[model samples]
Target: MAQDFDIRGATVFSGLTPDDFTALAQVGRRESYLPGETVFSGNLRAQSFFVIADGGVEVLRREPDGSQTILARMGRGAAFGEAALLDGHPRRALGIAKGSTTCWVLDARGLARLRAEQPVVATRLVANLARGMAVRLVRASTRATQVVDQRRAANSSLGAGEARRSLMDRLFGR
Candidate 1:
C-alpha cells in the first residue's frame, strides 16, 4: 500500500500494514485481461494467484464429457488461483475474464522474494490465503450437501413417465 495502491477491498490481503503492502506490491505486478481471455488454464501447473482489481472473472470447471461449468463469478477484491500460493499444483479449474479485468498477479519468483526478504509479510499473506480458502471449501461442502439432499427428495418424488437426472444435468440440460 504505497499511499496509492488500495488493498482495503481485498479480504485475502486484509490486516496487512503499509510496509507489508509496499513489499507485496513490489513483488507483484498489475495485469489486464480482455473479455473472454483466460487468466489461467485448467489442468496446467499453476505458478501464480490473482487478486482482481476491476471487472469480473468466471471460474469454470471442466467436466468429464467435455463441458465447462461456471463455478463462480468473482468481482473486484476477489482472489482466484489460490492453490498456487502454496504449491505448483495443476489448476483444478479455469479462470477467464468476464470483461476488461485487471488483477495483481503474484508468481513463484515474487513469492520467493517475499518469503526470504519479508518473512512477516509472507506469513500474513499465506495465513490470509489459507483462511479465505478454508471458508470457500466449507461453503462448497455445504452446497454439495444441499444438492444431495435435493436429489434424494426428487428421486423419491418421481412421478410416472419421468426420469431422474443430476442437478448439473438439469441445470445444463446436457
Candidate 2:
C-alpha cells in the first residue's frame, strides 16, 4: 500500500500531474532516522530534497550560543531542502528527527535527470517550489510585523507608567 502512496499533496510535488507524480515517486529513495538523529545539518552540502513519509522532523536554527531554535516541526507530506537542491547552496538549517521518521529522498542528480527527460513535469515542480517559498516568506513577514507591534505596545505602556511616576513625584515632592 505504501508503494502506491500519492505525493500530490506534498508542496514540492503540488502542481505535478498524476502521471508526473508517479514517475517522480518511482525515483525517490526511502530513508529512516531515529529520534534525535540528524537527517541533515546546517552548512552541509545539500544532496537531496525530502518529503516526510511518516513521523516527524524538526527544522532547527543553531544560535551562536550553541543553542538550537526549532524553525518548524514537519509531519507527513512536508517537504524540505528544496532551496539548496534548486540552487546548489549549503543547507541553511538543520533537520533532525523528532521521532522515528521516514522520508522519501530525491537527489539533485535524479531531479536533473527527470528535468532532462520530462521538462513539463520539472517545470510544474519548480513552480510549486517557488509558490511554497513565497508563502513561507509572507508568513515570516507577517510574524515580524506582529512582533514589532507587540514591542511598541509594551513600550508605550512602560512610558505611561513612567509618566505616572513623574506626576506622583511632583505632587508629593519626592
Candidate 3:
C-alpha cells in the first residue's frame, strides 16, 4: 500500500521528477488515523505536512462563540499543513479525520533537512504549494458566485410573483 501511494501524486511534490520523488518518499513517514481523530488543532505549533493517501479530513476553525466552522473538506491525494513547514508558523486551523484515514506526514525538520541538502526538491515543493493555494482560491470564488446567482434568481422570481398578486387584488377588489 505504501508503494502504491506515490508521493509524486501529492501537490507538495507536484512537477518533481521521478528521482526527486524517490528522495522524498525515502524521507517521509506514513501513518494511519482512526475516525474522529484530531490530526492537529488551530493555533497549535505545526509539526508536519501531510498528504492524504485515503479517506477524508476536515479543516475547521473556531468562531468567537466557540462553534466550529468547517473551512474545507479534503479527500484522497490532498495535501495540508504544507505552508507550516515553509514559514514555521502555528497552524491556522484544525484538521480532524472524517473517517479512517491514511496519510504521509513529512516532519518539518525532515523537510528542512531535505531542503538544505536538495534545493531543487524544495523549489518544486514550493511551486506545488502555490498551485494548491491558487486552486483553493478559485474554488472559493466559484462557490461565492454560484450563491449570488441563486439568490438573484430567487429574488427576481419572488418580485414577479408579488407584482402579479398585486394586479389581481386591484382588479378583483380583494
The candidate that wins on TM-score is 1
**TM-score to true structure, per model:** 0.75, 0.73, 0.70
Ranking the candidates on TM-score from highest down gives 1, 2, 3
- Quantify how close model 3 is to the true structure by its C-alpha RMSD in Å: 9.7
Off by over 4 Å in 3: 43-47, 137-174
TM-score of 3: 0.70
Model 3: lDDT equals 0.77
Error of 3 at 153 (Å): 18
Which residue pairs clash in candidate 3? Answer: none
Better of 1 and 3 by lDDT: 1
Task: Please provide, for model 3 over 45-147, each residue's C-alpha lDDT reduced to its tens digit, 9 standing for 90 to 100.
Answer: 3657888898889988888999999999999988887667667786878888999988888877777777887888877777787788778789988997786
Tens digits of per-residue lDDT for model 2 on 54-157?
A: 88889899999999898888898898877777888768788889899888887788788878888887787778878877888899889977866676666667
Of the candidates numbered 1 and 2, which has the greater TM-score value?
1
Cα misplacement distance, residue 7 of candidate 3 (Å):
4.6
Candidate 1 lDDT by residue in tens digits, 1-174: 333435456998889886888898789888778999888785432568888888888989889999989989999888877776677775777888999988888888888999999999999999998998899899999998898778868776885334466666667787
For candidate 1, the clash count comes to 1
